[model samples]
Target: MATYDPFRDLDRLASSFLDTRRGPRRMPMDLYRDGDHYVLTADLPGIDPGSVDIDVDGQLLTIRAERTLSAGDGVKWITREREAASFLRQLNLGQGIDTERISASYDNGVLSVTIPVSEKAKPRKIAVSTASDSQVVQAHESGADEPQPIEQ
Candidate 1:
């Protein structure tokens, strides 16, 4: 009689499931703030640049792309698969964002977006003075002795 090990079988099943879930379906991105603009970058390889779309509605930002995998007329792929992808990322603009001036660019399999900050949100420079200009006067009595001039 052979004994069945449940732990060994569970581990193998979990590893296989994770492997199938990795690829273009789950793209990673990075967002950062640079000076007066916010930059967003994402990695999307083997995708047609013309098929990508970027949109901003209210405070939400969305990115989507579609790619069709096909083979030549004379050749055939043993396994043919078509990939369609979409990413939804919402950013809270709060009260100090200039959405009208936003710009975007794509290059080298990477997408970059620039969102400008509002004028009110930028830092301002203020000047300070350390000198006082108030005037003071003191009156002397009529009978007072001839005031002696003080030497400088």
Candidate 2:
């Protein structure tokens, strides 16, 4: 009791031809900003953790993983659909991202990357001085003998 889709098969065939030299395939990913850090998650199921590679060059982040299929001797294959393939994904981190503190982790067939925002890009509050402090600063700037009253 399985339904067949002709369009799905056709699309798969076309993709196989186009992706022959492009390695395994591009896995789906999600990128979102969480507070002061940006989080990126990618789906990479059935891939060995050791085979996963993450690299950051300039403002570009690259991720690669490989999936291998093994068969035992004298084993008869029936309905083999999963094939060995390499997965590659890249993302461009903009200027506000802190490249030095970028961290990545892989767990449960999912890869998560955390990118911190640069200190310079984060908003900061400026301290507002009292009226007396402003008056002192104004007196210092004017080089007056006594502290002058600050005009509103």
Candidate 3:
């Protein structure tokens, strides 16, 4: 025999009223730098691939998606927990990012974006030269590139 719990029913009612999802929701994502580019992955389960929209405006990146539940004309929901919802997320891309080369793909309910780093932002080594040991010492002492010899 199942016992009736008034407190449990009250808690369920309160949760139903408070947990109703309306408007756009935020999706969880992960971003990390891989080699010369950044990879961003977001979870978007139960979303149609065609419904996923990604946009890059200036330095801002925005992702939007919609999830819809099927409801037939004669169907009645005995316990409806999942509802139709829209998901949105935006990120600010800083300098050194190659926005023009940004690419994205969706597979297995996961969205991935690749942001390449600009060539100018890459690390490089500079070559150093010295005219002579004496010149180097004199230049350092005089705080100049080359020390002029005394005219006799």
Candidate 4:
């Protein structure tokens, strides 16, 4: 014996209309820096890999995907919940990013993007010339956190 709640139906209807698959939806994602590259992973379940599109325009990175529900010959949906829709996400990559080498891959419904920092942007050691001679000290940029001796 299943009971139907009118309030639940009303709420569902309201959300469905507000959702309006015609409009773009947001994709859940996580971004973090790993070594010299940044990794961004996003969830895109029930979406075709072919429908996924990623592009970089100037400093902006854009992602778009579309999801569609297939209904075959005289098929009826008992309770249609998942709405067919489009997803869009964009981020301003800003400067110091090596946009030319940016790459992305989709696996198991997760979209992963690898963004590498420009060579000049990477932290490097600068050789400090000393008047006293033989030993070499290292000078790093202000934000490098440590100033250690250069290894041979």
Task: Please report, in order, the local distance difference test score of every candidate based on alpha carbons.
Answer: 0.70, 0.87, 0.88, 0.92
**Minimal lDDT window, size 10, model 1:** 79-88
**Index of the highest-TM-score prediction:** 4
Error of 1 at 152 (Å): 34
Residue-wise lDDT of candidate 4 within 1-152, one digit each (tens)?
98978899799789977864578999999999999999999999999999999999999999999999888899877978787889999999988999999999999999999999999999999999876766777978678888867744
Per-candidate Cα RMSD to the true structure, in Å, reads: 8.9, 5.6, 7.9, 12.1
lDDT of 3: 0.88
Best by the lDDT measure: 4
Instruction: Give per-model TM-scores.
Output: 0.59, 0.73, 0.75, 0.77
What TM-score does structure 4 among the candidates reach?
A: 0.77
Q: Report the C-alpha lDDT of model 2 over 32-114, residue by residue, as the tens digit.
A: 98999999999999999999999999999999999999989999987676778899998888798899999989999999999
* Colliding residue pairs in candidate 2: 24-86
In model 4, what lDDT does residue 124 have? 96
Better of 3 and 4 by lDDT: 4
| lDDT, model 4, position 39 | 99
lDDT of 4: 0.92
